[model samples]
Target: MILVLDFGGQYNQLIARRVRENHVYCEVHPHTMSLDRIREMAPKGIILTGGPNSVYQADSASCSPELFRLGIPVLGICYGSQLMAYLLGGRVETAPTSEYGKTEVTLRSGRSKLFAGVDTKTICWMSHTDYIAAAPDGFQITADTPVCPVAAMENEAENLYAVQFHPEVMHTVQGKVMLKNFVYAICGCAGDWKMDSFVRRTICELREKIGNGRALCALSGGVDSSVAAVLLSKAIGSQLTCVFVDHGLLRKDEGDQVEAVFGPNGPYDVHFVRVNAKDRFYQKLAGVTDPEQKRKIIGEEFIRVFEEEAKKIGAVDYLVQGTIYPDVIESGLGKSAVIKSHHNVGGLPDYVDFKEIVEPLRLLFKDEVRTAGRELGIPDYLVNRQPFPGPGLGIRIIGEVTEEKVRIVQEADAIYREEVAKAGVEGLGQYFAALTNMRSVGVMGDGRTYDYAIALRAVMTSDFMTAESAQLPWEVLQKTTSRIVNEVRGVNRVLYDCTGKPPATIEFE
Candidate 1:
């Protein structure tokens, strides 16, 4: 196993994820982890994650000095590289111009294990305000860039390496190869971590943990929830009960899809409960237009509903959620700031009575979750399903929640999805329609008509956190628009959202 020391880096979890993607297991711990703890872990290799802080700052993050003496391969990235340089008797200072995007790195000399089989000149993603001016004692400079001279350095004797550019991100085409070299060549690790093995081990552990006690899972139709439910059913069989709350905010056929997956004749043969809390949720959300407020109400109400269901089923030993790594990080599970409160993450209220919260997929990213789902024999459609927010269609509608608005958006969204599937747009992340809550005057049948405007949103993203608007073929958009205008009850007008994640989030609200 590889141990990733998190120094408050935005991509700490990403580092661990990349390691796992290479079929090697790794864990992320804080940089302040004690030396004794490191010894206890006995990881094959150590990785220092990049952070937003500088090592020279008054109270910036620093690790135990004895970490270098562990006699294990160590890799320092960005802020981590700077920290290693400053602590190891090298120079680190602020750069004249910060590098925040893609940059080129040129190999200096020698055959380094880290860059084994990599091109002499390659591109890498850079995000740092400071750079290492000099290599630490006994370290050789391996690569250099115009803006950052000491871009890569290593000491073969100590099995230590440092890089100013992020090889974990996708922009670095050969980043994963670099990681593989570190894990296999330098660290002497057996790259044998597989999803099937993870499943077997997790099931064994779950059986032991639950121990004849029953588990109640919040089985939303999303990939994470479905996978969690499938895993729990495999672990505890009938001892696990899945409660699916249809809050009247889900997409078309979403509830049916969930039922088909967990039904009696399904692969798991699990017990399931489908609660129709549509009116209850809609009544509570009546006239609420603010996005944050809507999320809060939906989150709280979801918990209350689940609490009631649990009471009905008697005492449940645990509450299972489909929480994943991004959810954990975004909810401030680590030192990272809270980006948003996910319904499954920070959305739980104080009234929950379950003895404990169980999240089997908590350490995984979205793609990782999908891999696990496929490993468990889940259907491809359900496993590769597009991401859906916990607040459901409430957030999809840009304004107040209403039955009419929900219906319009659902129908429009269904048509949009159908067209997208027909177009066979490869690598499309998410595509749907949102009710803009604004109407424009239009001429239909030679009559002036005022109807709500529908905005079609489609994005292409590997990770849901960052996305770019999908450059769908104009013909596909034309088909989607024509169908939505003609078939959906929405009287007139369809528009496409051209904005990306920075200025506009994937969801309208």
Candidate 2:
């Protein structure tokens, strides 16, 4: 296994993900990890992640020199490269002009294994203020760029490599190729990590941990929970009970679909219970206009309901959750700042009655989760379902949420999805409709009508971190808008949201 030492970089998790994509298993640990603990895992290679600090700063983070004597391959990035240089008796200085975006690096020597198949000129995603001015006595300069002289360095004798750009990000054209070379060609990894292996190993581990004990899961009908439930069922069989609460905030036919998948005729046939607590949720959320407040209430109410159901189902030793890697990182699992408070991550109230919470998918990403789901015999329709927020339509409505607004938004959202699928628009990552509080005036067969407006959003993204607006064909939008305005009531005007994720989130509020 490969171990990635996290230095508080934003792309630390992305680096681990890339290594996994190469069919290699890896784990991320903070830089402050003790040297004795590192020796215990005995990883085949080590990767040093970048951070947002300069190496010259007195309070900057660095690794213990004893790590180099482990006789294992080591690869350092951005800040990691600077730290390696400064600690190994090399010079590191702040660049005259910091490189914050994409930059071109020119290869000086093609003999290094890291640059084996790389082109002479490659574009790299760079975000650094400090650069290596000189290599250590035994190191060789492998590449350079206009702004930085030591873009890449290597000491083949010691299996040490360093680069001043991020190879995990997709913006870097040859990033993945470089990682492939390092992991396979240089480090000699077998590349034997696959979804099947993960499934088999995880099942064995779960059985060992939850022996003869009952476990309960709160199913949200999303891909994460569905996959987690199926995994648990595979391990403990009838001992697993799934409680699905239809709080009336889900999309059209969502509850029925969940029931169909987990019912008596379904694949697993595990014990299941369905709760219709629509009125309770609506009443609790009444008079709450703030988005944060609504999310908090919804989260607390879910826990309360789950506790009530657990009592009815008898004693269970564990509570299963569908938490994934992104949820953990976004909730500040490491030194990273909390991007947002995900309900499944940080919304658990203090009134829970379970002995422990088991999250099988905590270390996997969305795509990896789906891969594992398919390996467990789940259908394609459920495994490939689009990403949905935990709070459901509560955050989709811009203003006050009422029965009328919910119905209107649900209809509009369904129509938008139907039309998009029919048009064969496969490139749009996620598409939905947001009910705006603003209304517009439109002519309805000679009558001037004023009603609520709907905003249609569609984005193209590989990772949900950054996205660009989907350039959908105008004809398709025209049909979608016409259908919503004519078929869905309380919507007079339909507008397309062209804003990306940075300026606007996928959901309105």
Candidate 3:
């Protein structure tokens, strides 16, 4: 296993993801983790992640020099490199010019294990103010850029490596190759980790933890929740009860589709209860427009509904949520600002009835969750289903949500999805239709009409945290717009959203 030591970097999780992609299991812990614990874990390798603070700061994050003496391969990145150099008697000072974004780097040591198959001259992602002015004694300068003298350094005999440029990000042209070399050639990892093994191990752990206890799963029927439900069922079988709440915010016919899979008539052994709280949720969401407020209301209301259901079953030992890594990070992790509240994460109420909350897939990213889902033998359609927020279509509508707005968005979304599938447009990470609050004047069959515009959104992203707008074929957009305007009527025009995740999120609200 590879251990990632986090120094509060934004891309720490991305480091773990890249390691896992090498088919080697990895986990991230804070830099403050005790050395004894690290020794006990005995990871094949250790990675020190980048951070915002300068290593020379009085309170900067650092690790013991003895970490290097442990003999386990260590790879330091950015601030991590600075810390390593500083702690090991190497000079680290403010760069004459701070390197940021993609920078051209030249390899100084062609024999370096870290750059085994990498090009002699390559572009790397650089983001650092402090530069490694000199390599520590016995460490070779492996790579360097114009501004950063010591872009990468390594002590091959000691199995210590440091890179000022970020190899975890995609901007580093051959970053994956560098990481693969480190994990395979340097650390000697077998690269045997697979999702199937994770599935089996997790099921065993879940069974052991919830033995003789009742687990009430908040089965949203999305990929995450579905995988969680099935995993729990495989573990505890009859001890698991899945409660699917139809809070009127789901996509077109989503509630029924969910029921058809997890309900009693379904193949699973767990008890399935479907709560049709459409009007109940609508009543609470009446006149609500603010996106955060809508998310919180829907989130709390979901808990209350589950509480009512749990009470019927006497006592539920645990409440299972499909909260994935993106939900946790975006909802706010440590110093990271909250992008938005995920209903299962930040939007949860202060009080919950269950004895404990269990999130089986909490640490896995979106694509990782899908991999685990496939490993658990979940159906392909469900496994490959587009990601849906827990608050459902509540966040997809811009303003106050009414039954009419829900119907309009749902029908529009269904048509949008249908057209996209019919067009065989692959590589779309997420695509859906949203209801815009704006109403415009237009002539329909010579009659003047003013109505809401349906905004269709499509993005291509590996991780949900960052995404780019998909450049869909003009014909596909035209066909989708034509169908939405003609069929699903709150009565007006259809618009395509061209914004990406930075200026705008995948969802409208």
Best by TM-score: 1
Q: Please write out the lDDT profile of model 2 over residues 1-509, one tens digit for every residue.
A: 88999887777887888999989999999999998899999888899999878887888788887787689899999888888888888999888988877799999997889988889999998888888988888999998899899999998999999999998887778999999989998789999899899999999988999999999997988999999999999999999999998888888788888888887677668898899998898998888888877777888888788889989988889989898887777667676666666777766676678888899998888889999999998999999888877878888888677878889989999999999999999966688998998988888989999999999999987666556899998989999999999999889999899987654666676
lDDT of 3 by residue, 1-509 (tens): 99999886667778888899999999988888899999999999999998889898898888888999998999999888888999999999999998877799999987988999899999998888889999889899988888889999998899999999989876688999999999999999999998888889999999999989999999999999999999998999888889999998899998889888888788677799999999999999999999999999999999999999999998889999999887876787664457789999999999998889999998788899999988888889999999998999999898898999999999999989998999999999999998989999988899988999888899998877657799999999898888888897765888878887655777776
lDDT (CA) for every model shown?
A: 0.86, 0.86, 0.89
- TM-score per prediction, in order, is 0.92, 0.91, 0.91
The candidate that achieves the highest lDDT relative to the unseen native structure: 3
The alpha-carbon deviation from the true structure for residue 215 of candidate 1, after best TM-score superposition, in angstroms, is 1.0
Native-structure RMSD, model 1: 2.5
- What count of clashes does model 1 give? 0
Candidate 2 segments exceeding 4 Å error: 91-95, 129-137, 287-293, 436-453, 462-468, 497-509
Model 3 clashing-pair count: 0
